[model samples]
Target chain A: MNAELPRRAWLRQNAAAVAGLVFGGAATAATRRAASPHRLVWQIDPKKCVQCGRCMTNCVLVPSAVKCVHNFDQCGYCRLCFGYFDPGATELTTAAENQMCPTGAIRRRFIEPPYYEYSIVEDLCTGCGKCVKGCTTFGNGSLQLQILHHRCVQCNECAIARRCPAQAIHRVPVEHAYRMKSQAASVTATWRHKEDGPAHA
Target chain B: MPKRSRIWAWSWTLVVAASVLVASGVQRFPKPDFRSGYTVPQYTPPAVERTAAREWLDVGLLTGGLVLAGYFALARRSRRGLWILSVASLVWFGLVRKGCVCPVGSIQNVVLGLVSPADGIPWTVAGIFLLPLVAALVVGRVFCAGVCPLGAIQDLVIFRWRPLPLWLRQFLGMIPPTYLAFAVANVAVGAGFWICRYDPFVGLFRRSGPAGLIALGWILLLIGTVVPRPYCRFLCPYGVLLGWCSQLSRRHLTISPDQCIQCRLCEESCPFDAIRVPTPPHPDRAAARRRMVYALVLAPAWVVLGAVAGWAAADPLAAKVHPDCALAAELRTEESTGKKEQSWETRVFRASGRPLEQAEEADRDARRRLRRAWAWAGAWVGGVFAVRRIALGRRSELADYVPDRGQCLSCGRCFAYCPREYVRLGELDGIRGQP
Candidate 1:
């Protein structure tokens, strides 16, 4: 009887592990069967966004935690990015007080002539209509929150879908969840320069 | 009567069936096995509609049933008119509003937001404090006996009539006050509400959230099976607050000596230990008066001293990564005008401030000393208040046990434990049936 006790304890512990394994296998099978095309909620047509601040406000989250991410290669290195400053700009100061939008969504980086790399700090983004509207109105749709698929809860039927006005958001195949645009030829040349030739090209 | 029993049995069967279905629902729509996948709550504003009905039911029943049971017990000891009034008030405040000032949810919210400051005060807290106060003043601590959400949960469980070791309960009780102090200080600093973050049972009832918290809930629920509502007893700040309020509350759960069947039944039945026999050879008026004076003088002083001591004691830790500490760092950072300060304050503040500055190490030493002095002062104040309570006279000789809502997390054990209430309301009234 004493000898049997150890065996019984082992079974008790392993029972959960075994059940988990079985359940996991079944869940995986179900997931495969349930899989429909993958979808991306956020997309940036950097050229189209007018920086109107619509995305900042209309979003459900309080802080709107979504901010613009810049793909340097895709950028035109424009001197006046709608993403950065208001059209009626007086001075190009980096101080938060002097920004186009009320909240400072744009972070400017100095690179070369007439071209500065700009990025969005997301947590501060209120999803107000200003930035998105601005970007869509002026420059390339460079600024948009692509609903970072990983961050999304992936509710089987998206909640935001019912509310989206433009209906610009669509479900893309999961395998190609995000569609990142390659830079223009000139920008591509710059990108390849370092990789192919001079170390710091 | 037979029909009532039949109805009860049928309802119980249905409840069991529903519980089984709901529990199994987790199994059917098998969530992703990935540790992070289905379990972890990604950062998102919690949606109100997302709250599952089962969870809401559990929360409502737990808070409602226990308070109701306590009321019934206490009512038996009081005048019939007083009892009726108390019951009506309880129904209006506790059950009608669904235990809004539910100590359980409020305490949990406070804990959850402690690390994150942006969170707002949950509405349920307003209900928990207000309902009980209104009830106690008008009807007496009927909320404490039968209607409080947390008390209901505890009363419903705690099956074995074993006495917890005094030293053990005392040691455990210390945790809630410390938690209370931590919550109050953090809230004052605009740090994330500490009360809501780590609530074990709220997570359990909700059935989904961040994996870490959900796991903690399950552990607590399992613990509840053996130890009663451990969170309500040990770590709830709201319970601590209510316990104090109940102490001062005029319309308390009073037992009449005329009903004198000194059966000791109520004493044994009460899980909260609110009921106690009056100690013999009570202190004379002079002694009582002296004690009351001491209580009045020492209580506020102790609170201040305790606050200071607690603050000073934990300053070094608080200075780092505390949300409030971040505010101070921001101030110092601006004062330096980008110039590096080598002071001790700089070091303590550096870690908390945004856009980390390397020179602020100097501020740490001075800050630590000041905070320590403050903490010592606070401890003395708090220590005195605790002492004065012992000196004060006992009001109720035999009372029904219900958790203090200020510290309780509204877990459903008390409601489960009150057998008489369970019989009256049926098990579904106490149990959060599946589905």
Candidate 2:
């Protein structure tokens, strides 16, 4: 029983120390939470994106968070796509020289003799904006870059956002994460058509 | 053929057959044929994305694990509870999470964030990195006890306890600090995440990645069967930070619940050899003081030497950080040899219409940053070594066996072995009862 006295004292001392540590930890956690903006996460607006290729290099992750997303509704289903074919292509073949994407991310398929369909092979896309730039310049802006939310760790201040020349990236509600141009354009078109009809009458 | 030679020959044949089986199993999917007209293969990208909800779940698991580890190690003192927690952590963190956003690899992220404020870190990453460290400072290395998947995997595989030689262990212990220094320096200069790149077990968890790393993981596990957390002890750069926190921990794991009877029954219970035996009184205090003074005097010189070494290696280290630097060098070589072909990276650089001088300028800038960072890292490494040497040289008096606070993982293995603890838990009667 005599040996227990010092041990109990030690325990009491340690308990106080533990209490202090817990209090300190709680205070720090509280302050960090207060300092951070918690509810929102960064996303890229497809229409606003100029495809400057900053997303490829400026992202903190080795593979950038920005990936090419196909909006089939916006696509014209052209036989010769600006996004798929090289400007100086000799033949409309699936040859390496005829491809526009530096990584061959755009895959071309033959639907019939004179028609073909194009889709983005995401794994190969480097977010270089080369294909997006081509498509936006010549064809309907069907192929666009979007932040793959799954790949994004949602940094408090995104690295790519800071470097984006067009200021395309912005924080959006998690519930409405994706900011696709096709959906926005269609909504605007219907509103425009209704406004035009009233004006004509 | 001799019996041994014949056996070796049969084993080689069996290994070849096993490799073929494994390869065939891995490639069970039908190969795509481009020649038979273009049929667009439905590309199903691997679902390895982190959602906000999933990130929260990981954070929740980490926080819960820390609390449970502390309770098991300190309050309950249940080795069984710790074992269960370890296994659960292995499944959750190792297998389910697939070893990404781990505390071990997060050290690089935190370092990178600190160095380059532009590369802002995720709050979740920051929280995951700091949580265990704060926990360690309060409750010793309870994080290592059952919370860390790396430590848990190693702890589970431990069967035969074979302690390394004192000199060898001490020498190997120095590796973590050096590793920590290099990882920080590399990241500070925008070098790739070396820790994640070389993670031995991540490949095993994902069941894909480079084969060489998988082989290394298996080898490490094989060694861990006897060595008891070889990575945690000798390699993990994060452990260096944890050890420092544990050293100043408020309330660490104790071998006895009530009193140390000095029975020494729990002496060999620790698989990691973290138990400190009772030390005799210092023979000569004056001599010890002189030795400490000498060590203090030599510490600066050691720092300078380390700085010089780091500065010298800065050029090579800088090359690793900027891909453009390596590409430029390769392009120059190809140009001098009159080779018309250009690599993909060089082609991309040229196609971008950026001046070659710009790439050179970036390389130079990266090298300058690397030199400064490497020098500081070297000095830090030197300081660590000096402190370690002094710590080793110093002698302390101990009345009873206690867990070495810095080295002890707070695993609670010794608690079950302690007679006093057994009695306190009512597992043993006070008089003439076998514990």
Candidate 3:
């Protein structure tokens, strides 16, 4: 082919071949070296959350995938629950004005004398972490934010993770999806969080 | 620093830390004693719904798109076929998936994997990233023509040809490579993924995001109505890599089936301004040789100059982009002022009980790495463009107008405008087949 064409054309063709090898070769090598067996998705470690409320706004989803979660085992179940009631509130009722949660997402119910259970309304929970801040400061750190796997689009680099000042968001394996509190701690033992009980959704 | 204030800040931080740690482990009010009959309800949050099978399916669909795009561009030479395939790709990849594991964003994943010890790139993601480059090397930019959702979305809005002056086009062309260099550097230094952070079209695809990003997307699409795939030409980091392989394509797309007839219609037809007008043989071989020689000799100086400029930007980039460096700077301020800002990071750090020196040391290491990565990437960008200029100035053997291999996306748009193509398609009767 080169014998039929001028010298410059022949040289240019060969240069193209050489350029292909260099660029394609390097890209191919990078791709091969980058392979992994495990699939990973973005998650937030409940233990590391500082309740800065960045999770509420930083998510690409309109209403962020980050939601307020309750760890039932760790809850003190107190009637004067700090997560549900504002610090200055005179009444411990579920009145909107006295609620620590801006969206009124936390519901309080009487389970026993002086023992009340708190549950989060996922739709209304803005993940503001206002309640999380109150809970961590005044009560047991049972209320924390976790990235819901079902709603998470799983961006290559999670938008919320990048801005999370606490740096709690991390990539975890798909099997261990939610970093939820899973164990029932004994009275003498420290609270343990791991995959336990029938918690699959 | 005053001793009292220093002691005050330290004690305050420690007290909060102690309370938080104790709060996590110990219940303030006892969980009902063993004698009580209360049962704690189990609260399980949502689990992963999308499965491994979708990844395989994504890879398969991408491969099918690439194969179909190549066939439409090269074998069939039908612009209509290409557009149909492109719209389908945009719906599936852009609208339905809403942009995950895309080739454009995967560049960050590749660099992040190289820098960090986190699980290497997922096999599905690697395939998504590498498949296009492979196609470009074998054929030419088959990905850009119809397969890439980014290109497709931009392709939809382009209604007119508003070609910029040659000088401005040449100047703007350098952006993609420079953007690529900075994106890689940002990832290497533990800066957030700037590519995903500022992807102009993500807001449009997902139908919601920060107003600024959504506005940017709309503005680009508005400009694209006349400017024609502005992101593809000027901003896409991955397109720079595609251009490299496309230039060396084994079987390049030809604007004409047989020979260029000097008709100049293809040049008028292309919105991308990718068609190169014929350049007659040079009168002075010596002058041309001298010009090429000057570019080759001064290439190192261009690279060094670029590196120096990039090094200047590296300091601020490290402080602002990387999370740890920002934290370290905040810590330094607190140590000097003896007043805490109540930032989340500091509270968490104090509670974790890690020494301040360790964090400061990590920040120092991060800044140095970021600087070197920026400088090296800048140098590479400089060298690549210098070589590109030299190549652009060189002589071509053909006397007829031809497609620029590096720039032409091979979208098959020009195929309809060529008179020779009309004859090939049997739409014109004057010319039967090429003699």
* Model 3 clashing residue pairs (backbone): none
Considering DockQ, where higher is better, how would the candidates rank from best to worst? Answer: 3, 2, 1
* TM-score attained by model 1: 0.42
Predicted structure 3, TM vs. truth? 0.88
Q: By lDDT, highest first, what's the ranking?
A: 3, 2, 1
Sum up the clashes in candidate 1: 147
Best by lDDT: 3
Residue range A1-201, candidate 3, lDDT tens digits? 112256755776687777656644544454444333457778787666788888998888979989999988778776678888999897877778888988889987676677777999999998888988888777776887888878889887788888776777877667666675332223112111111211121
Predicted model with the maximum DockQ: 3
Write model 1 residue lDDT over A1-201, tens digit each, in one string: 012256655664464344334433432332232222111223333222334344445433334433555444334445556666776667777665556656676677655444455666665555554554554345444444455543443322232432343333333333334433232223333323422442222
- Return the lDDT, model 2, position A110: 69
Which docking band does candidate 1 fall into?
A: incorrect
Q: What's model 3's lDDT at B12?
A: 100
RMSD of each: 26.7, 16.7, 6.1
lDDT of 3 at B215: 95
